[model samples]
Target: MNSPDDTHESTVCPGCRAVLPSSRWPETPKYNASPECAEVAGELLGFEVENAARLGYLHQLRIDAYGGQHVSPDAPRIGPVFALNGLYMFLERGSGNLDVRTAHGIMANSYDDWPRLVPPDRVGELTAYDVLIAGGVDEVESALLKWARQVWESWPDDIRETIRELTVELVPERYFRR
Candidate 1:
């Protein structure tokens, strides 16, 4: 067995398929995660939590973007749907006005019959590594937004239309005027 101190060559994440350094942790089967990708995700989560004050409004956006990219059929169906809708609210709506509680309620109520979504073959080129490497708050925020946009656009055309339809159906009309 490889010890935590042992270093190995790069491995690919099963979720986003990003080539990443081998994780110190041994690989164990997960729904849509691998050791390396999980390690990077942990690092990004740490950064977001540590710098939540500096991250401000972008915190949820970053989380949703990452979640959207890493979805799996074995996971809760709401994961991808919620992430996509969150991205749509923030990116397409031009204002992050969709209340989280309202969105959650809508999803819980309306999405029970929705079919499970298959993750795209390619999520996005940028990963959490890109945001983590950005030196300062401004740089990190920029990187995070860029990554979110790319991930949002990476979904299939039909899936994106579903996101739009869901948003229009669930969100309050007033939120869209802005």
Candidate 2:
């Protein structure tokens, strides 16, 4: 019932065409949009959707035993650790808009003292450090989440919850809770 011009037509990622809301069609999936769309939507939305995709992929891998057998063998793999990595990477490298000012500030501080903030023991578990010299990816993600919540208590509820839910969804028990 909507005219072409009246509706803001935007191309959607084939990856998320079905699940995304109309408003989120062209939006970034990392923030509840689509994984493919995230890369072009800037740090906030892009990284958010990337995190979601990572969560989704991990959920499939661990709890659902799902995956894209067709994806290129050379392509990078996605998983729970990657979700945390994506979240941390975004926090460290994302561009901040006005709405994300506080979040950005928290991210900035974390970025500045990431190594010191997360002790060697913790880092060991979260990054690929042991194998790749980066340590454990889990510790970095957990620390990032903790720091984010502590520094920006006033961050929007749903946005924060989205991140939390995505992270939770990666857990085997909670993966399919929704």
Candidate 3:
């Protein structure tokens, strides 16, 4: 019988389909007894492949909306478009745009066009841009929808709009360099 390590194939780079060795994956912190925390942690870490893929789709959509390229093949290597829950949510920035595995692709977003309503204090060590350009369109929509349908559901319609206007595209601005 195959061991747990051997039972499943190693995770490969979704962008390039590069076969990732077992050693290449991040060493997650040890798991405790609580299955709840483990599940939460996995969700947060983009370990859930389906969820990640959804988020990645959203991320790409947002980039495309901003006139950014979907995939920049020619740009120098930056890194893989991140996946969470099997979704491709965020792409690494390179050549002043989203870096795709393919060659000659250059994608960029208009940072200045984004609103600056996010509080400087709440921004913490991260900037407005950092939070905006981080995830794919689907992931971001999921997060926004979660907040809208769950936590902010009871909020006034105007309030919901206000909150979303500030936080909706947090990834691109947050991650994309000026």
Give lDDT per model, in order: 0.75, 0.29, 0.28
Tens-digit lDDT string for candidate 3 (1-178): 1234653444432221223223323332331112222222234334224555555434333322211111123322221111110012222232122332122122223122322221111111221122233376554455433321222123234533543343224343433322
Model 2 lDDT per residue over 49-149, tens place: 45663332222111110111111223233322233323322343332222123333344444332211111111111111111121234543343344332
Candidate 1 local lDDT, 27-94, one digit each (tens) = 53433767777777667777777888877578668778878888876777777888888888788876
**Top-lDDT candidate index:** 1
Which sections of candidate 2 miss by over 4 Å?
A: 1-8, 18-40, 43-74, 78-81, 85-178
Model 3 ranges off by over 4 Å: 1-39, 43-46, 49-51, 58-148, 164-178
Residue pairs clashing, model 1: none
TM-scores of all predicted structures: 0.84, 0.18, 0.20
Candidate with the larger TM-score of 1 and 3: 1
Those runs of model 1 whose alpha carbons end farther than 4 Å from true positions after fitting are: 1-4, 25-31, 95-98, 174-177
- Structural RMSD, model 3: 15.5
User: In model 3, how many backbone clashes occur?
Assistant: 51
Q: Flag the better candidate by TM-score, 1 or 2.
A: 1
